[model samples]
Target: MRLIRWLVPVLIWLAGCLVVGRAADGAEVMLPEKFQRLLPLHEPLGKPGPFDWLAHHPEPGQTFGQYVASRPVVPDRRRRTIYVQPLGEFTEAQQRIVELAGRYLRIYFDLPAEVRPAMPLKLIPASARRRHPEWGMEQVLTGYVLEKILWPRLPRDAGAYLAFTPTDLWPGEGWNFVFGQASLRQRVGVWSIYRFGDPDRDDETFRLCLKRTIKTAAHETAHMFSMLHCIQFRCAMNGSNHLAESDRRPLWLCPHCLAKLCWATKADPEKRFRDLAAFCTEQGFDEEAEFFRKSLAAIQGRR
Candidate 1:
């Protein structure tokens, strides 16, 4: 079954492609063509460098049609809230970013989002914690966080349960460290702000940290609904093997991926763009704000 791929332990960080091609299950999904209007406003994906995720892990990209055909997880009236669980202590600035992420998720998905009370790191056992042999940075086990800590506490009303931490994360042996990790079926995911940069730094660095956190948070949450990476355009869903590549990726979803998000979340693309543009403007993301404004205009048939 196609779900077998998702059931297997898979960890997706802020990550993909524009293949409006056949789905693995070969089921067809009728998509609205309105999203096609935004194509002129987007740029195609550039060639990948040797260290980029595409260069190493070439994937058959999923389109809006394929995504819907897959019968992805979607929010329902009973299970419509996104819960942000804090796993460790965070600085005041880091806490602010987490709160903002929750707000952004609420706006981005048109779902209610809540930031839960902080959970002590002491709750994690020694078995699930480790110190990197080479880097000497203490790290948390991503698998343990998902299965052990998050699974048991999964709230009945949660569409997605995401854990935020300040520690580095590692999936398992042989893997060095991960920016974050999420399960496709589990509804639980975790990411660290430790490497996102010190938000306590100056204003520029704070904005940078905020942008990275928001990107990762939104990207990982999307995976919970089975949205794949976009190879079709320069998009928020594109994968990155390293920080540089991720930094280069825009904070906007491509038209194809945007279609998937709107379908999955039952969101209005026009309203989503307006909300995003407003948020970006407030956050001093001038370029992204302008792009979203243009996207809004394009979709509305405004010249």
Candidate 2:
């Protein structure tokens, strides 16, 4: 079954090549045509299941064209860096995850991604802190972190100012907790590692936690660039109602969302895939590395 899951994308890539032929020199065709050839390599999203995110949110998804038409935020010369602000306390292992996440963001967006000096969580006032009535877990207000803490400190050269905390977060009074939250226009966001599991537990758990943290970090930062939740494919940009749904999402973007990232950040598709593959390989994300390798091969007309 796992083999089949892996082979399906390869088969799709082959079929896409037949449908959209390569040039005489085996180079990919021109701009949009080259991009179009890659689209069918990704599977279209099917109907949402009972507990799926779309079953609840029902978003009208954005396409690459729509994304461009929307005049989505893109990094410019004056605002080109992505900043990661560490909030509260992190274990040594947890801090490693944060550092890796920053590295991933750099390659993911083809931008400078740096972690600022750690900021004290005491900055979040007592009024913004609470204990979950049912679970008794300590929680911090997501809004306060974004608006009060991060927004004010957003650097002039920052394309996105992101905060990562070891603390749990609740969006407001109604919600139980959020894995993360971002302001679409403000270019600032916050995510919690509290729910991603303990990195010190075991190797498997460590990788799992690292993967989840990077996913949320990259996903939320993409939002700051004005990319909407993906509904077209099994992509990293897909909305998630819970951990199971989130875990089901791919670590790589589908072609459509990839185009958005490329367009917004002026990233070279081939180089982006290569860099991501290298990072995943170094970090022991074998499956994700394989997928990125395939993406690089597909784009380079090697398969």
Candidate 3:
């Protein structure tokens, strides 16, 4: 099913109010000196357009201090690898995106990531499958996948286990479809590339599909570590209600969210930026590469 899209003009005004005044006040002071340098390079989220995620969700964004206080789930000596499990058959192009997403996740979180062998779609029994009421597309129940498929097969050393499927997903009834879904406490999530557009169409479309896949993968994985939707900046952790909103989000985290990830994974801020910069450059994502390089420069005091 095509994801829903619409615009709600007056709601844009409310997007301004999504950030808690206290969180904004404490944002900078909560992070280390290096992370604070990243503040000026990042922009606050633009006003949400009609039918935007922020306009409808209205989240009171989390701050670095808030995230730390939550005692979030973080990787330990025993379980630190992020595992990506393929749930069904994928086109050569689609498979390429999946593999790249695993590599991106490694740099994005500074975690060890592995792409496992594909699990046949037939593994998902008929009970968990349904044809969308109106859209007529075959959809899998996300809850079933998370609990039955992912949870059971979760590896002993996995910090987070994510199922990458080419199938459509619905969390349950009353919702049409979702781009992806994750379990905050379970450390298991499932996302689909089915709605991300066909990567085989062209070079530009392939890059677009790769970017979108990376965004959702990183965004949902952070949830398992207890990072909430970012309200303070235009960031990867920000809640995306649809493809348009997700596309508007950058591939990097805001300082506050970056601080959270760095702390959770014990990753060095400068090194993380440098790695992402190199990865983007290698992938032909010139704009994203420049942004990563600029962020690294900010932390290194070169800018």
Task: State the displacement of the C-alpha of residue 217, model 2, in Å, after optimal TM-score superposition.
Answer: 1.2
lDDT of 2 at 77: 96
Question: What is the Cα root-mean-square deviation between model 1 and the actual structure?
Answer: 10.3
Answer with 2 or 3, whichever has the higher TM-score: 3
TM-score of each: 0.89, 0.88, 0.88
Error of 1 at 36 (Å): 1.2
Q: Residue-wise lDDT of candidate 3 within 145-254, one digit each (tens)?
A: 99999998989999999999999988887988987888877799999899998899999899999999998899988898888999889899988777888898899899
Please give the distance, in angstroms, between residue 224's alpha carbon in candidate 1 and its true position after superposition: 0.4
Top TM-score hit: 1
lDDT of 3: 0.87
Q: Candidate 1 residues 1-303, lDDT tens each?
A: 678667553423111022324446523443466777888888889788999989998988887777876878888889889999988989888899999999999988888999999999998899999999999999999999999899999999999999999999999999999988888687999999899999998888789999999998899888887888888789999988999998999999988888888888899988989999999999999999999999998888785
Model with the higher TM-score, candidate 1 or 2:
1
Cα distance off (Å), candidate 1, residue 143: 1.5
Off by over 4 Å in 1: 1-31
Model 2 scores a C-alpha lDDT of: 0.87
lDDT of 2 at 45: 79
Candidate 2's C-alpha runs over 4 A off are 1-31
